[model samples]
Target: MKKMIILFSALLVLSASGNQTKAEQKADVSNISSANINQTIEILSTSNADKSLVEKGVKHAANLWRASDGTEEEFTAFCKENFITDQAEKELVFEKISRNIEIITGHFNKITLDLLEPVHLNTFEQHPIDNAFGAYSVDSHWMNDFYQNKIAFIIALNFPAFSLGEKEANAKNWTRQEWAYARLGDYFTARVPAELLQEVGKMAANTDVYIMDYNIYVGHLTDAKGNRFFPEDKVLLSHWNLRDELKANYANKNDGLEKQKMIYQVMQRIISQEIPEKVINKGDVEWDPYTNMVYQNGKTIDATPEPNERYQQILNNFHANKAMDAYYTDQNTFIKRQYDGAKEISAEATEKIFTDFMRSEETVKVGKLIQKRLGRKLQPFDIWYDGFKARSGMDESKLDAQTRELYPNAAALEANLPNLLVKLGYDEERAQWLGDHIAVDPARGSGHAWGGAAKGQKAHLRTRIGAKGMDYKGYNIAVHEFGHNVEQTISLYDVDNFVMNGVPNTAFTEALAFIFQKRDMLLLGITDDSPQKDALKKLDLFWSAYEIMGVSVLDIRMWKWLYANPEADAAQLRDATMQIAKEVWNEFYAPVYGVKDQTILAIYSHMLNSPLYLSNYAFGNVIEFQLEEQLKGKSFPAEVDRIFKQGRLTPNQWMVEATGNDLSAQPLLKAAKEALEELK
Candidate 1:
């Protein structure tokens, strides 16, 4: 989901000042020394506090106390005064801080939601001014303000950030309040300057715009023999729609192979930056992706390939993230911050999980099964083979017709939200409450769930609706996004504390989304009567996890590559990306598909826009399968409500609490094995 804007606006703030380089942003040196830390700890030793916590907190505050913040003496005095030793008073202070931060973050989220409407929603024609406004961050300097006013030092001295290891080792014994305090500690762990944060925000906005408007008028595409394969008005956004279209053609009896080949060619051209510039987002020209040729009214014309803009965007994102490395001493690189700090899972462990799972014998078994079903040799695009789902056998045009009749526009979808909830076994009153809290909007791009930050603000569900109405693809994605909205609502509204009002990470939300997405047919009153339905579901989940895991590994390795070659230009980075994509594919995918040197794994749009996020979808599939198993023979709505309300526990902790098992791929692998046996 594109929920980053809410995060950016809520956590970071803007400074009303001039642009500053990285060195200039880090000009304020720490004034506190080891002597100051020792002195402060000694002064606080008389209080009945944990000595270990005191030492950690004092040292943490010392490191962040800048010369501009105060003198060493003043730092010592601030720690002495602000540090709470009494349990009752400390709890009271924590509660107050939680309330204040909720107010601050909630309002900032609202501001960003409003400012981004023109760009995010299909409300009007987008202008450069709209993008500028959308990119303007209001909270970029809020952290600086906090430090300047001594609030940051107060937080640091009280609730020092815990390492991921510490949290995992000790959190089982901690209370809910202590866990909330730990989350609070995470906020001030870094000190990125306002200007750098703003630049990051602008880059994020620019990439969002780029990814959103990247539409391909597939109807205008012509094959080498000048044959049209798609309808005249069918436009698709890359690479989501393109991939879906490829999947949809699996059920197509007429020209399905040719269409899949055409789409595959289009994807390769996009990844290699060989697509004609004039053909993108424009239907005035006919292009043959296989020949890399452009035509106007039956006349071939010379066309320049896109100038490595895709790779350039990735370079921009890398530089923007790399600029903050100096400030994050604890997690020096963006990779560390993303995995250890944000995801609360180490990158090493995540990679091993994916690679080990991808190498499993079940992968080859599943691939053989798919190939048997298709009665053809496996192609690179078969990675998205969709025949396992009930909907895969049905005509997509029929599903589109049904959806369009049901939901003619955003308003129609909004009106039917409560009913959709009720279909999932929610009672009328509860469904109304959820539907009331979620507001649907017309999306300019693929729909996403932008969750509400505060209780009063409504969560916005941006859904793409064609001029005719909501198509089947849009409805399916809408349901998936709806799952995110539901999780966002339950976690926020039912959690015990405001500080804990969310999932542990995006993966948890994605798990819920997958759960809802797989139920799209059920929601439409279409049930799979096959006795093999359960096994089919397992195989589907396994195949999907198998596909995305490779993509996620590629994403992680590419970031690592960029960090190693920080000075590489766009073309050089593109070459590196291509190399890494092939390496990953050959290692994990080639044995199954009997294909090598296929770079289709690199065709994911997330590689350019959402960094380090592909892993969540793979992990989410794992979580989704486990959760589905847990929900069997239980009250579906009750189980979902109860599990999600646990809210923001550490990943494994949350999994254990919800499913009586830790997060692992073993469950899925075993289930898929059993499924293969049954299907065979």
Candidate 2:
């Protein structure tokens, strides 16, 4: 996941209104007063130039210039000295700034990659120096330096920053260069201290490390009857691997439901800080999650529960983020920065979309269908029921065997990228090019795709590959991450402007990942020609969306609670999180699942480490479904290249260009209703 602090500066100050809190009402940090703005504009308008353009340039420069930058005289002189009157001259300056920023940022990205190697990669055990290096942001000082050198002032003078509302309203008329200029304005809008950014990075890195190494020896888990359901030496990482393991058991005939129940219990213990500290990442003892007891050599032993370490990490992340909130005068809270700034969509809008979809009749319809398939009452853990997938009935062991043989290591998977792409409709040459641009690595945690910031630098795809080999679960995650690499490679190397080198937000890239994940079976040469396959796919998407939307709601509510209760301790935060999860579950999920007060929705690791990222998965499903509809009759690879090449337009604009429709849950919901009828 991208560091939240890196994108924290991309905010425009919102106007104060009645609904805002007192703290939020004070968000504006513009250095220029209304009188000063008028003075600067009048002085610049006297020059023989377009009065409108001169006024805009002067006001923009005034907004960014502080007393520390200069006195009012210097601000006026700076605007008069730097504002470009000629259109051709302005375009030339824009190009120069874009090219130079690309060069600077590219090198900075490379430097960070090298410095973070020991921390991110599994090359060696992390040392104290590694932690410090990983926390250090090479580009943290760039903003301060640019402002001090007057480069930032020059850009602000020429390319005025646009509010999120302004961009949404007028983006249709903007040229690509205009969009690039708007992005440039976003670069220095916030003046957070470099030291604060470094601290945020360090806190995030520490949390990442803590989560990455959090493993549970499933084989050491025993039930009340003293029977181990998992294989010997089977280790699963918290929450991702554990959850995936629970889903995988739907195909197991012997003790599938029981295994899932046990995993669910383990998740509860972890979320509540009831899991024993010594048993974590250690295979030396057996434990029963239900009784919260440990055993060695068939004898019960005492162990202390983990002392709120999980919640402490989350608190540390919050404090680090909270420290920088004051610097963001407009988008004061991290929620505002995430939504209005990074997501380019309002939190209220996102929450409405998620809740509307979850509460729709289509969700209820699909839940009934899942219940019918399972031939039993739904449990709280049924949120993860894997019955909708094509492989739900197949033997997971056989699939795992096939994957293990095909991908004996990360190198083997890397070598097969070309063939996988070819199967998805890329030509031999194009497939080779994409494969060349992506590097696969053995991940120490759940897999993630890290896109290259510069041309020619390979995007890293990191997934777990055990000593034995890559299993089906790892292979599946690798394919999903590969989609991110493809989008990253295309947007960076093929896009026309360096400023527009990525999608509008992480959600757009996540849409591509979901698309590739849906085609994992296709990549493995497994095809379904059944007429009901399309309907099943729609149902799968709908059901998965239903599940994650609740989790997203929990994430959103938890963050809001944290902000409201900033002085709350770890234990208090944990209690609040569980209560919020239960509230969300009761309101939107209980009716469908026939269960209430479920805390399963609160167990996502991203809640603790990444913060407010769960919404992207839900949004991604909506986009992926729309893109899938658009690609129905087109060449897969060709359509992918065409759509991703449009570059970082706003989410709505990007969706319109890619699918000829706006991003909406209605399309998926409509299809889901039709699928439910057809299936019935």
lDDT by residue for model 1 (457-572), tens: 88888878999999999999999999999998998899998878888778889999999999999989999999999999999999999999999999999999998987899999
CA lDDT, every prediction? 0.87, 0.81
Q: Per-residue lDDT tens digits of candidate 2, residues 1-680?
A: 33321222322221111111322333336566788778888877877778865676676667667777887777877887897878899889988998888777777777877787777766568687887888676776777788889998898888777778988887789898888878777776666655555555577677878888899999989999899999979999988899889989888878998999999999999988999997899999999999998999888888999999888887776666666576665676778877888888889999999999888988777778788888888888888888777888888888888899999998999999999999988999999999999998888788888877767688888888988798988988998999998988898888888777788888888889999998888887788777899999999888888889889888888889888997889999989988998999999988888878888888889987787788888898898899999999999989999999887788898898888888899999999988988987
RMSD of 1: 2.0
Strongest candidate by lDDT: 1
What's model 2's overall lDDT? 0.81
Ten-residue stretch with the least lDDT total in model 1: 11-20
Q: Candidate 2 has what TM-score?
A: 0.95
